[model samples]
Target: MKYFFAIIYIITTVAINAQETHKRTLKLMGSRFDITVVANNKTEADTYIDIAVTEISRIEKLISSWDENSQTSKINRNAGIKAVHVDKELFDLIERAIQISKLTDGAFDISYASMDRIWKFDGSVTKMPTPENIKASVAKVGYQHIILDKEKQTVFLKIKGMKIGFGAIGKGYAADKAKQLLKQKGVQAGIINASGDMNTWGTQTNGDQWKVGITNPMNKNNVFALLPISERAVVTSGNYEKYIMINGKRYSHIIDPRTGYPSSGIVSVSVFAPSAELADALATSVFVMGKDVGLNFINQLKGIECIIVDEKGKIVHSTNIDIQDKLKNE
Candidate 1:
């Protein structure tokens, strides 16, 4: 599940003389990417945006499981057959994904790609899967079975038919990488919004901090708060858009890989962190962790905050974030 954000800005007198904000929205990595850059003119902004597009495309080819020639596909094809050597970048990404799996106690697992897709979010489903079928659906899904060789920079899956994919983290990682490359090229301020995974650097053209309006889960067209963020990443995972009802109960599209069942109890989770990659992973993790456990887990981590909206429309936030002050309707 992904959420959308509204970019808020207050025009100032400096806008006429200062660098202007140029944005281009295009399709990249099978998702919509809105790349915005602050530049003196349109040509320079287009140049910077093109560079970011190239970088994002490169990352997609490296990690996309659908592309048969990608290194990730090679690794999946050789599962339980042999250890396939991969580039250091891909190897390191897999290693970090494993670390996150352990930290979340298996709440977040790339190996979840191997699970059978028994739960459909489309409106056609009228009932739920049985206990036995649900249990067997996740038989091949286990991160513990994934083996990494640091010496050879190889990845090996111990079980046949086991695979891994980065649907949750790939876009955010691409956004972070694009932002990094643009920054190195002296693009002072920009935003790479890969759907709802947003990363911002520097400030707006008017020298004001970039702000994003948090969408109200109860009403998709309304916003509850507008929070100013600088040099940070924010990601929101919500079930409001994609979910199914069975026996008058709603089940989110975000399935818990361990149980082979869709997640419940929470409607949305928004996480703020230093990087979009971390924020993306944590947002999904919080949904699976439930409201209470997720809030506790986030409170323990420094430099990280989250806001959760339960099914009852009740809102709760981490220790560091004060939503009351940012409420747009207040």
Candidate 2:
């Protein structure tokens, strides 16, 4: 199995010949969600798409840290005071995030929300932050400080201001849940794209595989390759749009939780995995780990492949990926 982060934002799904593919674009979870499904009739497609929208909304209510009434907000409100009991679904998600944190050695941390906004990429700051300021920014970021009580189904933060936010992994998790809900309802094929976090199952109406175009980071308009996929998740994390160039160095919006510094050297990291949730978090982790370390880590994982584009626009893939056949014919 091969995987890559294609320029999904610029390419829409296409079908060969005439086919009935119903699609709806909506704003959900604070991102552009394009939900497409293949069905024999419009009513069936609309109904199934509604089910997906409802499922994704339910997840947002349970995990959104920004909403005061959400369980996640409640967990943050009581930080350093007491453990807040939560629903089984939210609890399990947090538990899995903690496990990923350990796997990446704090590079992928949910506690990153507590980081201070000392560095800005809005073209505001002219000089790099002082060493002391950078050190102080991540004072509250440590995955070990998050205490999860499995028996009580509660979450506790060891510090008063420490918080957990799913900005990096939430959309992918939402996409995965939505896809599972649709499949359970007997929907044969569809694509759930939560911003750039996408999940697909089955083929198109014409029986052709789903084609995803990989965008060249150096030349954004040109697609370097086209990857055919089915029943898998593809997530791309890149700093190309959100970054600041200072003294000829490009600093991305993705920050390294370990150092409180913006990740540099890599422009984009696309991950392919069994689920969008894992792919989303791992893609961000690869950005922080850089090319050598990131490629090695991805190669060791089973059923996970990644494509990393370095600062110089050179493309690198995991050990299993071969570009001979994946390059787009067009």
Candidate 3:
């Protein structure tokens, strides 16, 4: 009888240990935040995600120019006249943005915000803009005009009234930073899914990798592909966010810095890269680059891949996409 009781106790201990798991999810930074940490104890993982949320929120404030008193707005207000020193994280992100602009030949410009909102996404814009309007809009859209004084750690928009904002890459950078914080906190496996911009690491409970679904452009209710992912980031950009109708044609909110016009041709573009920052910037660049240019640009990029859907509803994927066989779409 004693031996039988001891065996039952041993089995109970094993079952309890097997049931151990941890996950945390919340609304933060105007987006969804999800965290999964695999450990023998749930308390430790929960504590780590809490710490990560606080750190990421601090960064959002520093870089969010939309906030009335953010550090970036203060810098934009001062412009070239005075340099406002920022924390290293903000400074580094801006610096990297400039590099991406140069690499993509201004396709991924941060200074594109300097252009006025004459190209409204509302239904009121019934016709295309005149040549004069197009020319004037791009006058301040040059990426080269974004001035960064490395010595002083200040970001200056050289053109007066020009602005710099991270509407494109902010979420991705935040996700990347948050993932780093989690890894530093000893999280062995997890995902930080910021909206649709997700950064994943390690494997699932069954030893399989994270499976990410690519939404079908033609049918929002269906997924066209199920890609297995691990230790990577994916971000999607599309006209679904905002648009306008002109001459019975839909124009996306994304503008081309070169043409001073809202972009079209591609309905959506999702990029996968080693870090969320790259995925963020690439998604925006690909949207502005249009279908052909965007596809070529992604192909040339190392440590990166993409899934691009054209306005005609045709899907194009990077040569390297690793989709699973179990659920191949028709």
* TM-score of each candidate structure, all chains considered together: 0.94, 0.93, 0.88
- Candidate 3 per-residue lDDT, tens place, 1-330, comes to 000000000000112344344667787777766666666676776687787788779878988878878988887787657667877778888899989989888878877767777787667778888989998987877778777788888777777777787877777788888888888877777777776677888766556666777765555766777777789988776675467777767677888777888877777777889998888888888888888888888888887999887776787887766656443332
Worst 10 residues of 2 by lDDT: 1-10
Ranking by lDDT: 1, 2, 3
Clashes of each: 0, 0, 0
Clashing pairs in 2: none
lDDT of 2 by residue, 1-330 (tens): 011234664234455554478899999988888899887778989999999999999999989988999999988888899999999999999999999999999889998998999988789977889989999999989989999999999999999899899988898999999999999999988999888788999887778778777776777886776677789998987777778888899888888998988888988888888899999999989988888999999999998998877888887789876443454322
Winning model by lDDT: 1
Task: Indicate the TM-score of model 1.
Answer: 0.94
Query: What local lDDT does model 1 show for residue 126?
Result: 92
| RMSD in order of candidates | 2.3, 3.5, 9.9
lDDT of 1 by residue, 173-291 (tens): 99999999999999999889888788999888778888777765786666676677879998877887788999988888888888888888888888899999999889989998899
Clashing pairs in 3: none
Tell how far residue 294 is off in model 2, in angstroms: 0.7
The residue ranges of model 2 lying beyond 4 angstroms of the native Cα positions read: 1-6, 9-19, 322-330
